[model samples]
Each structure stands twice: as structure tokens, then as C-alpha cells.
Target: MIPYVREIQFEYGACDQVSPLIRRVVANNPGPFTYLGTGTYIIGKGEVAVIDPGPDMPDHLEALLAALEGETVTHILVTHHHTDHSPLARPLQEKTGAKIYGCAVGAKAGDSAVITEAGHDLDFSPDIDICGGGAVFEGPGWTLEAIATPGHTSNHICFALKEENALFSGDHIMGWSTTVVSPPDGDMTAYMDSLDKVKARGFDILWPTHGPPVRDVAPFIEAYIAHRRAREAQVLKALADGHGRIKDMIPTLYAEVDKRLWPAAARSVLGHMIDLVRRGIVVTDAPEPGLDSDYRLAG
Candidate 1:
């Protein structure tokens, strides 16, 4: 079974009306793709917003149009500039003439930008800029506050629906597997800080760009926090076990990680190692250029 095809239903707003906002328009991403993200529909009074238009596939775009047959799209909000999520921004904006909004325009390391496996780039640029934190858009009855959630990407942003008490989490907090923290673009410290920031706000629901919606925010945040700490601990252990380099630690520390995704995993480990070095938990001669870096537990 494909990851995004699964149907998820959530009650919209404070009303008893349940709306099926997310529907899988297209499946399969190029490269060693394990899952395709769900295209989200935010239905409002007279206007609508589509979040993370997945890829630029014709069928997917057509499906999106079909889904919003009788509706008017006021804005196309991108959670992040990732290919799987933001590639369709341009094409969708062209089709609907809606303003595209996101953190910024650029590609990040370990992202699908360089690799065209997932889908072709739509090369869309938003009419209005919402990059810096606190940029907001107010619709008829709904308003979206673009919260700067950097770490996953330098320009990554998440949308918060003030009226609904909900948040469009993007890849920051997913219902499925843990998000890949690939660095150069992705920073572990920033990611951890973003999580804490969201937790402080206390949202009621999380409408992630992928997988199912997170109904409970507190416990979910706690688990995610714990998971990262545990991974950091594992990294420390790997260093103590005489694993001098990332390559040496891969098989022993991240043995269960997918072979195809090892590169991404290694980047994440490197990010953690960087953090450990800053805290004196680990010592590195110098910042590793790539993934190969000699590291040892601090005395």
C-alpha cells in the first residue's frame, strides 16, 4: 500500500462537519522514493488555499483542478520549497491565478531539487513574499500565519490557522516516519528549536503535509523530542564504541536505515555530530566537508 493514498478524515473548525481536505492526486516520486505527500485543500468561506501541491505531474494538477472544480483558490501556500511540495506551486498558480506564498525560493542540500526523480520543477515564484517569520494572509473567514520553521530547510515555513486552532506542519512534524534532517540546508539545532517553538504555542491539531493529521499535539511533540534525543544518544554511543568516522558508524549505528537513504541518514548523523562537538560531547579535528568526519567522545 502506498503511503499517501490512505484516506484520512478530520473535523473542520469547531463545527461537527467533517471534511476530507487531503486527497492523493498522484502517486510515486522518482529516485528511491518511499512515499508521495498528500495535496491538502483548505476550504474557506469564498476563497480556498492548497498547501504543498505535490509535484508538477499533469495528472496530479488535473486532479487538483477536479477537486476544486467549483471553488476559487485565493492562495497557494507552500510549506517549504522542497520539490515534492513546492514544484507544483508555479503551475498551480498559473492555472488558478492565485498568489503563491512560502518562506523563500531556493534549493537546499539533500533535497530533491538537484535530483529530478520525484517530478519536474514547475519553477513557480510567488507573487507576494512571505519569507521572514510572521507574514500573514487573511481570507474571508480564515487567516494563515506563516511561522518561520527553519531547520528542515533554511527557508522552511509552517502555516497556522488562527481561527481553527490548527497548523499546517509541513515536514516538520509528520504522522508517519521521522523527517530526514539533511544538513547544509537542514540544521538539527534549528529543527529542535522549531519543535520547541510550536510546542510553546499549543495548537490543537496538526495538518501535516504528509501522512495523517496529528490530533494530539502535546504527546506527539514529546515523542518527537524524545526520538531526537535517543538518536543523539545513539550517535554518542557510536563514538564511544571506537567508531572514528561516519562511514565506520553507519552499519553499526544506523544498520536498519534503508540503503538508498543512507546518504540522507549520514547527513543527519553529521548534523548531530556537529551539535555534539559544540556541546563538548564529541571532539572533531575540524568540520567535515562531506559526510566522512573523524569524531570521538569528549573526555
Candidate 2:
């Protein structure tokens, strides 16, 4: 198991200070994917920085503005271009006159993958691509180092708070659930590499956007990587046993998973197959390996 953290105590549109410098305001939007909702983070005190402005709900925006009644929002930092994560950035920026900083506009993923909670927002263009240059953002009392962790999307970026030795891990590494790596934007190979990059950073805590903090950093990450490796092993085993298509492997591979999430699971499996095909461990019959592609082990 990945030691998933599912419990969180918070009210909708209420900004609660979870740490000395971090105040989180949960959006009213809730579902199977979003857990309680998108937790928009406010970092620092006087001149604050906001991470993951979340969905474009008017009430959520009002609550955010209310939370920073006296403070100046100098920077609005986004994690990725997912509709749940970055759609409010534009409206928030208009209200506070804060410069938006984070990943660039997202490239279109394949049409087959439907990101259930909120789809990608192609219109979300940041003022600064933090991945370029030094990738550092500083506020009154905090400094955030942007770590490019593309996998969930080609443009995903996680921010590390240097003052607290914590990372505001976006959708890259959630504490609640395993990240959805759908293609062609979601690359399993890049996702695995990013996991290694984060593990090497050795942060004390990870405050994911969707759920509560991950306190046990090292072991949790190890389990996460191990879980993926195990999934790969299972995929190979399935391929060896005559399960050559993603749809065929789904029932056994994700037997415990809810049927509703099977489509999402299929997309993830496709990501793995794409990686496997690239490494020459498997061969695909389709022009490009996709959800419907047939696969077999290399001779």
C-alpha cells in the first residue's frame, strides 16, 4: 500500500491555517476525484503567495479574497493547467493584481482520455514559466522553488517551500490517491523519473492540493515507486498470460477499483504500455500505442 492519507477536517469556503505560514481554503466542489475539494493554499503573511488557485467558483474566489483581507497577494502560483487547479488564476489575478507564475499553457492530450474531475484548461497561460531560469519565487517570509514534475500533464510543476522544508506537491504525488497518468500528455516514463527527482529532494512534508499533508516522506515515496513497479510486473504477467489489450487486462489488474474509474484506469494502463513499448519490452500493433492497442512481449 502507498500509505494514503484520506482524512481531512475542513469546511467549504473556510480558510483555515494548517501551519504557521500556510492557510488552506477548500473549494465547495467535491466529488470522487477531488475528495473534499481543491485545497487552495495561501503561503506567507503580509505579502503572501497563493498556490493552486483552484476551480473558478465565485464563492471560492470570494472566500480566498476574504481570507487575505489585510494581506497583499504578491504572487499567485499555479501547479498545473488542470481545470480544478488553475482556472481561478485569471479571476484571482484580476482582483489582486498579482502576477501569475507556474507552468505554461498545456498541450492537448489524446481525446480518448477524459479527466473526470475537471479537464485541462488550455487557456490558462501563466505570466512566467517558472521552469525556466532559477525557478524560484520569494514572498515576504517564504521562498518557493518550482520543481518541474511533468507526468500527470506535460506541464505539471511542484513548488517547494524552502523555509519550511516542505513541497506543495500538486497532482504529481497526491496523498489521497495514485496520480492519473493519461496519455499522450501523461507519460509514465517521465512520471517515474519525476518521482525519483522528488524522492531525492527529501522534503519533510508534502502538502498535496487535493488532500491532507503527507508527513511520512521517505517511506511513502518508496511505497509509491514500489506500487508502480508492481503494477508494471502485473502488466508483464498479464501480457505473458495472453492478455494483450488494455481493456482485457483491466478487470484483473484493477479488480478492486470501482467500475466508474475503469476508464481512467485504462488510460493509466495505456501510459504504462507506451513506456513498455518504448523500452522494447513490448510491441504494439497500432500505429501508436493507445488504449485500444494490442500488445505482446518482445521475442
Q: What are the RMSD figures for all models against the true structure? A: 4.9, 1.3
Candidate 2 structure quality by residue, lDDT tens digits, 168-233: 998889898888898888889999999999999999999999989999999999999999999999
Error of 1 at 291 (Å): 0.8
Per-residue lDDT over 1-299 for candidate 1, one digit per residue giving the tens place of the 0 to 100 score: 11222254432111112343333343234234324345454546446777787666676677677766788888888877667788777888888989888765555544552332333233545667677779877777777888988876767789888887888888788776567776667788889999999999999988776656688778888888888898888888777778778877777666776687666677778778777776778887764534666778888
Residue 268 alpha-carbon offset, candidate 2, angstroms: 0.4
Candidate number achieving the greatest lDDT relative to the actual structure: 2
RMSD of 2: 1.3
Point out where model 1 deviates above 4 Å: 1-36, 106-124, 287-289
Question: Candidate 2: what lDDT?
Answer: 0.89
TM-scores, each model vs. reference: 0.84, 0.97
Give model 1's TM-score versus the native structure.
Answer: 0.84
TM-score of 2: 0.97
